[model samples]
Target: MRLLALEASQNSTYYISRYQQVEEFGADLCVLNGEGTEGTWPEDRYRIVGSKHIDDIIAAARAWHAQQPFDGVLTFSEASVTAVAAVAEALGLPTIGFEAARTSRNKLLMRQAHEKGGAAHPDYRFVPELEDALRAGEEWGYPLVLKPTLGAASNFVFRIDSPDEMRERFPQAVDGIKDMAWFTMEADGLDLGPHGLIVESFLDGREFLIEALAWDDEVYLGSIVDRVTVEGDTFDDDVHHAPTSLTPDEVAAVHDVVRTGAWAQGVRRSALHAEVRFHQGRPYLLEIAVRPGGGGLDHMARVSAGYSPIEAVMNVARGVRPEVDHYTPTGVHTAAMCLISRAGRIQEITVPEEVSGSSQLFFFKVTAGPGDVIKRPPHGNNILGFLGATGTSFEDAMSTATELAAQIRVEFTD
Candidate 1:
């Protein structure tokens, strides 16, 4: 059966390529998110139909649906989740509904549903202006997180330590910074349903990721990744370890939370990625990106834990149950860490092995070059490259990955 994958992620690059490497599935890019992509994909196995508008994406999906009767649709993106759901529903396909997708996009709605569903979470308020957020903050307290109610990649998220900071950031609230599509800005700028930015009581503690693939009305969790991020980089969850740092009880606890969260949000069988933070022993929701975590997260799961997220995703898209073996770790540990390139031109690499080395050693997937727009303290899609490796332990896995990251030797040639 033909599968239409609605992915706008650069993360899917590795997954698509790995699928081709393993000769798994024949897939096509049903739509291009106009996200400009994190990087380019390989030239074979799939076709690209680039269109950023929802009507165009819907049109494309409909055309494909008439030709081959696509079995189902899959997505790893929030920007297009609603669109995909609508398309799939019209085609009489099985996937999460537009209602669930809409609820997932709004932080206010998510919190309310979680609360109504008896899921544990912090208090949050949504407001149209900075004043309401501040008012919510006054009620919540200092050290509250001010972020977009319907945002990904942490575009306008911040923390306020005092009333001064709140006033300083919000000041007067302006919209449309780059003429980046009125619809796009509207979606990012306004929370029509919840009606504004969210002021959530900050729940600080160790955060972990729970990625699951739902099929046959059952949810199968991949890995529980231990997450860390760059000092100010809130977009990407920087550091990741497979097999999770949680004990058995904690894992089970998180599983219940995830299942409840999905059910509460109206998410049916589909691939779901949830970002959760734990305080003292309770799991508090941070933010949920409808897609898989970027930065080669699926790749790291395979390299570190022997699981193929791409295959599982394909199963859901094709209405087939994935053939997944229970993972058994070898003595060797593995990891794939991201490498940030300083703003400069591509001059040379200190380690030549990256250009000509076996997979057992290390791997580099470089995306930036000199003369490119460089920013200090990388976050969000501004990443320069990736570093991956296998070692003997978790610490060793991280260390080796970092060492490989250092060897990446990128000189931004400007």
Candidate 2:
């Protein structure tokens, strides 16, 4: 099979793993990337210059397909999913369609679709201006959340506790929206005109993620991952563990809600990443992305569930249903911790022998070495590295990973 992959960065481990998986499946890969980002992939590279508009991308893809005649068009990156969907549809290939891809990226559209499809979601209002946001705050009450209509990695997401706080932080949130728009415009040439925000009631509950593979409108549950974030901080993710602490019944409940939300967004053949909050024995859909979860989620799934997310995605691209039934629980726990640091130039990184000697330590990687600049939070690229581990139990795995993370400290210059 000849597969056309759009926008796989050479520097990203996730993309590298994906490329390796495709080759492992004995497929020829062709990559399409933005102009300057060309030649990053080792496969047959095609360039789409300024204005990565959907029509332009499709046109370029059509020309490439005419010669090479690719069997599939696929992308794992969130920014390129919509473009891939359009190209796939244009080429008469299987995909989730353009509308579902658009709904997955736009929070406002997603909420509307979920509500219309009978999926429970938080009360939300689209605010085009500051005054509208203030009005929404009043109507939605305090402790609301403000975020961009189209965003990822919790960028520019703020939790407002009161009207006063909302007033004070409204400008910052607007700035975030503008920054996000500028990024999309530069990266994908996607002109997201003006700035808009979504204010929604904060759902107070335990957070969980459901990873699934969808085929023929049937969603197969892969694994339930419990998301651990810094308490009181809206953007900081501490860790993610697979085979969540939730009981079998609770997992089933979350699965039902996730299935509803996935179908509501028209996910037919894709990797589904759905986030839900469990409160008072009820599951509420938070958000859904038509891609696999990042931050070593694929590794977690493989370790705990005996299935590889990357392989599942590759199967989808190859016009085949993923072998979901082959996944069986291994009775082991896996966790991934994000190595974060403050803004500064790294002087040295110290990894203690105790941490390196631990039997539970699966792997440790430091992205920012000595002399590398590390930006603080709220910055788009802030992850210093990642640490992954496995244990007999979730608590043991998380505790060991946390202790190992604490030992490896980055010393910044004065």
Q: Candidate 2 on 1-414: residue-level lDDT in tens? A: 888887522233346556666778777877776433545567345454444666666777788888878888887777667767777898887778878887877788888889999888899988877788789877777788888877776767778887787777777767665666324632353333323788888888889876787777567778778887755636556688877778878777877778788888877788887889876668899898988876677777777887677777777876888778523577888888889878888899898888777778665656667877765434443567778899878788888888789888778895
Point to the candidate with the largest TM-score. Answer: 2
Stretches of candidate 2 above 4 Å error? 8-14, 36-39, 43-51, 181-195, 326-328, 345-381, 407-414
Q: Candidate 1, clashing residue pairs? A: 344-412, 344-413, 345-370, 345-411, 345-412, 345-413, 345-414, 346-412, 346-413, 370-413
Q: Give every collision pair in model 2.
A: none
Q: Best-fitting candidate, measured by lDDT? A: 2
lDDT of 1 by residue, 253-371 (tens): 77777777777777666666778888777987765545566556666666655666766666666667776543333334556666655544456545566533735544456655544
Q: What's the distance in Å from true for residue 132, model 1?
A: 1.7
